[model samples]
Target: MNPLLRLLVLALVLPAAACSTLSAQQRDRAIAIAAAARAPAVDCGQPDRCAEPSPLRALAGEAFAASAAAPDGAPHHYALLLDEGGDALLARVNLIRSATRRIDLQTYIFDTDDSARLVLDELLAAARRGVRVRLLIDQLSAIADLQILAALSGAHQNLELRIYNPTFNLAKPNYLHYAASVVCCFRRFNQRMHNKLLVVDEAVGIAGGRNYQDDYYDWDAQFKFRDRDVLVAGPEVRTMERNFAAYWDDRRSVPVERLNDVARRLLADGVPAMPPARPAHPRRVEALSQAASDPETVRTQLVARAMPVAAVEYLADLPDKHHGDSALEDGVGAAGLAGLLAGAQEEVLLQTPYLVLSDHALEIFRGLRGREAPPQVRVSTNSLAATDNPIVYALTYKYKRRHVRELGFDLFEYKPFPADPPVDPALGGWWPGQAPADAPDPEVARSELPGGSLGGSRGSAGEAQVAAKLRTETRPSLLRTSAPANRPLPVTGAGPRMGLHAKSMVIDRRIAVVGTHNFDPRSETYNTEAAVVIDDPAFARALAASIEGDIAPGNSWVVAPRAKPPVLSGLNYSVGKVLERSPILDLWPWRYATNYEFQPGPECPRPLPRRDPEFHRCYAPVGDFPEVSLGPKSILTRMLTAFGAGLVPIL
Candidate 1:
């Protein structure tokens, strides 16, 4: 045998030979220790203070009351968009602090940064208050200290933690172990739990693209995520609760004690008190914590913004989505979006962090375009300059023709540093005239951006120039070298850049959907995703307005055909279209379309529609990639565009 072939066989066999699950005795010991430890009784005498101060609960009660009185029973929904980083963080904080009965959190990624630790500390406090708390985190991306996981396993009987789909039946697996597992069971190893959900007392639920990380909540100094979430309370919450239960009860969801790493520590040492979470951004955390618990802030800022609407539905794909090849199906997120787009009568708006589309999604667009009265479609996604995964962006870059001409899409790609991002009043924004109460600490108020830029919102022009020249900043990935196509993200800019991570759609200005699905091939085919659909015109319009802000001229770059090269314009487009149709061999440098920038002047104060005759007068072509340089990732992106089309389905 070849030396490499012989080594490959040994490598594949070693993981099975060396690895072990919880033995019979180990399992019995864990059960005994768990049985001996019981959670303390509730000590709280007042329920009101412990109650999360949300007017949505009252709205939900009124909905239920109306349902009982109606001729035909139908439920009502109270929902508000959590588009700002501060607001999303505040919702989670208040939810944890308010739990008197039970709290459940489900997310794909759980880091040990200041933001995640703060949430963990809050959950521990809730458990101490005798509120039952369960935390379900996917194994691949989550990083919990072994001692902490072991201590958490038995610290409070009221608090239970579980890991979903562990590759080696362990909380902490090394790179070699990860590689071996992939070679051994490729499909199962790739199956990740991508749902981001938080349900408090089964009365309120928050769902969207946020994971438990600093960037997701705008706490990261060097980078931040421009994401969105929906705080919902209605009959649909019951469905979310049931879906969480389904995941919790699934055999794939193993208790922390059952994991090899956590179990070993539990057997060696008795349960210890949870270590206090140390915050890197103490001033910011303190300010946010005050806002979350303050009656007036919760009442005025959050409660007042909620809209009471009718017909909200929660949809989730079960863990069986990865059982086998027989499990192949359009996950709920993909199917739900497809179904909603199919019903489009006049207009559709779609936004995602990733731009890669699955085949089913492509088919839906094709059918819609074939219609005699096809609806106008507008898409908002990350530009090469703004995306976390430039590799994925290459696939989108590979098919710009299909997205624009074939589908008739008015596509806008988000910028790395938008002039304005929707920020909470508690935190001032990029532009002036915001409420003056940003970070409480003057130095900290610069908000983690180096050289004192404010909260990664906006930076000096020179600072941005330096950042855009970045060639080697990497994205957050949990894989080793062997992982397919895993490479440092060609982040055009590094420090304090915000990327769009919200997955949402608005249809006909009458219905809206928000959830964790990226609408990319990975979310559509691989991950178990969930979403919320609301059929309320007013709420849909509000969601539409939020998306509108994102696609504004200063915030995004429009994707459109470049000015005809003045000669061979016909041959140029024809040849480019033919090359783009293939997944590979699309090496044409002068493509049909490129990103365009909006130049505002006194004559044109507002943005014009793409089809507007005067559109070209106000917009200037900004090249294929706006803020990017020819770096390694760019080279790889170029290479992938030319020859890597076959890697699309699993991106």
Candidate 2:
């Protein structure tokens, strides 16, 4: 059977399977239990009205107040979290452990993983200490973990949990049920809350792309993500707290106890015993403990270390962003970010796992390219080999070359682990920010390129022109080897492949935007997102340095014209070229592939190279297909994904 036809058949069949399954006894039992477990309403008023002085005020608050009161004080102070995964967890745990008044956390995915459990333990501990803990998680991913959530909410009178936009079908809240829900009610299920924020004591907050999950914090043995976040303090935190309050108060956010009787009954059963979380590295834990114990000293140290920012603003999408309301009126969605991007003067640095430029965004880029002094725009995103979402990759892959030649932006695709050696700590460490010593100088493109002349044709014509322009232009070569010039580099031992999951942008060394907003259609149209824009040259430069490190030759691959190989070489770069041109495959969202070598059921998986012990050389080139990690999806999931390929724009 044709592969395409098979995928279509699978998509249709899986939904039918979901409908046919009749766990009659289980469903009836669930209904009965839910009916009996109805929770009484508790009057938890507005978050702001409930606010109290942070205990830190008596301890750490003086230091922050002093910093803010200084005659030369900037509006905000920021610290960039360079630790790939561990440090982010440390920051959150420390904040929770030290909070005096309240803690508000809003996120898209709060998985029941080792890292998540550790954080949950801290929240529980904080609640025990009388700190108010409010957690708002998107229901899309949290539905399966209802029992755990119920237990958490029930364990502490000071803690409250809510799930956003929950589905009506509560018997089995797995992906199959969600898929069925989507099938039955596409519009509602299609929209999600994609916000990631953590604010403590209404004073300090952490925001970025990191979620509370194993993969997010580098606890997953199978995968790791190179991501970024910002530790922020000052008046801006109050604004972030209010944003959380708004979401918490939104009609879409339903308290977990209110998620129907069955869910409540399930919660009444108590959370199952989870395996002990892997202990955090001793140094990380020690740091967190010290910070938590001496909030004043830590605040002083943080203020001393923080980069002073001229201005800062928090932005968020409406909890009802799926309604497609104009962001300008509500100060949500991507309006603020879009406006910030449109004002770039010197350069724009974008780091996102996914890149699907909206029409407005494309126009912004086009205008920048058309400028007399066009800003040097550089974008670092996951290569086919490094992405976790092939469906989104398919959409962005089709526009890769056009973004390069037409938009005149330098594009770098992140390489999986072992492709690059261990990064130097001074340069950003494993998550390096300094460009490779041998990376093509950004100044070269800035100097040689004439104003609007570098721009190519738009759309398909623009894509066709890329090849010809690449052959003719004397511009700095965008195609370069992925390996770093430094040899026998320091290694972090062997582990799973590393992928880019950071969603950030630094513009003109004056503004930095970091949050859960991916530069994709889903973020722009279907889901709610949040980000903080700091208008500090120092902060922007710090972020840009990290971004620059990511785009360095050692960390990413430059997708350029394939080079001719020796006659004996049996390479197949042609496959990539063909895939780039094949409109049919591009049209079929689910018909995506990767180039990474897959060793299914291997007798012995490959080991790390002796010289490069930082990453295992687990994969080899597999033709020209682009590689992506979708985690451990079952047959039904694969089918749903394949079938839903055409829905990439909305998904």
Residue-pair clashes per candidate: 1, 9
State in Å the error of residue 290, model 1.
1.4
Q: Which parts of model 1 are misplaced by more than 4 Å?
A: 1-13, 20-22, 34-42, 45-58, 325-334, 425-494, 630-633
**Cα lDDT of all candidates, in order?**
0.75, 0.57
Model 1: lowest-lDDT 10 consecutive positions: 428-437
Residue lDDT tens for model 1, 1-651: 466875796577665646656787986687556546646664465664265555544555666666667687778778988887777887788777876688999999888877788788888878876788899999987765887787778767788899999977888877667766666666787788999999987878999999988778866654567889998877778889999998999888999888776766766675556677777767667777777787676766677788988789887788777666346355353356678878898999998888888887888888889999999999999887777766778888888888998999999999876766654324422211111123335223444532244223333323223322444443454432433344334445545566788999999999999998766788877788988889999999999999988898878999987766534888878888898878758887777778888888997787887778888888898888787655454567778888878888778
Model 2, 602-640: lDDT tens per residue?
532433221233222343433333332223422323343
